[model samples]
Target: MPKKIVKKGKKSHKNKPTSKKYTKYKIDGDKITRERNCPRCGPGIFLMKAKNRVYCGKCTYSEFESKK
Candidate 1:
């Protein structure tokens, strides 16, 4: 005799919303907001600020200031 297999249908979980929260950092007025270009590297380089100096995703570099 062969055993019977049970198949289940897709379940719905629409009640929950899928969203992501990104951390944002404040930039000072003196902080220069220019298109970052790595001199050592090539073009298409940039950086993102999130409460502090972040690194260039493409270059993998980070910048930060020390508070005395």
Candidate 2:
């Protein structure tokens, strides 16, 4: 008989998705919202919103946010 192996101190991150990674545009009373995507990578790939820029993880394309 083979003994079952277990990994210790590892978090089960696969079960839950991170909320910070997703953001959708809201309208007056619309139930449907669209997610922002990277222009270089098309609609399938999303852009990462950082402190100062929006970045695409796939093609390394980045655009800086304008300062107000």
Candidate 3:
């Protein structure tokens, strides 16, 4: 067996949620809104908001932010 190659470039990380689950919801003039949900995992599963990307822990799915 040989040593596995390590890919270079963007790194992957696991960041804990900064706020409580309830804080993820918002109320605006009687209208309720919630954080974006993971498309791959469907509803009831919220996506974790990072500085530049949104991630899904259950399926390791991620989306990067576009540079302005």
Number of clashing residue pairs, candidate 3: 0
Candidate 2 per-residue C-alpha lDDT over 1-64 given as tens digits, one digit per residue, 9 for 90 to 100: 8987876886766866546445534454857565568898898677777898988888988999
TM-score of 2: 0.51
Candidate topping lDDT = 3
Worst 10 residues of 3 by lDDT: 16-25
The residue-by-residue lDDT of candidate 1 on 1-68, one tens digit each, is: 88788677878757754431112222568764454444445554545554666566656766663456
Query: What are the RMSDs of all candidates, in order?
Result: 7.6, 5.3, 11.3
lDDT of 3 by residue, 1-68 (tens): 99999988776777967666666688888999988888999987777888999888789789986789
**Distance from true location, Cα of 1 in model 1, Å:** 18
After TM-score superposition, the amount by which residue 11's alpha carbon in candidate 2 deviates from its true location, in angstroms, is 9.5
All candidates: TM-score: 0.34, 0.51, 0.53
User: Lowest summed-lDDT stretch of 10 residues in model 1?
Assistant: 17-26
**Predictions ranked by lDDT, top down?**
3, 2, 1
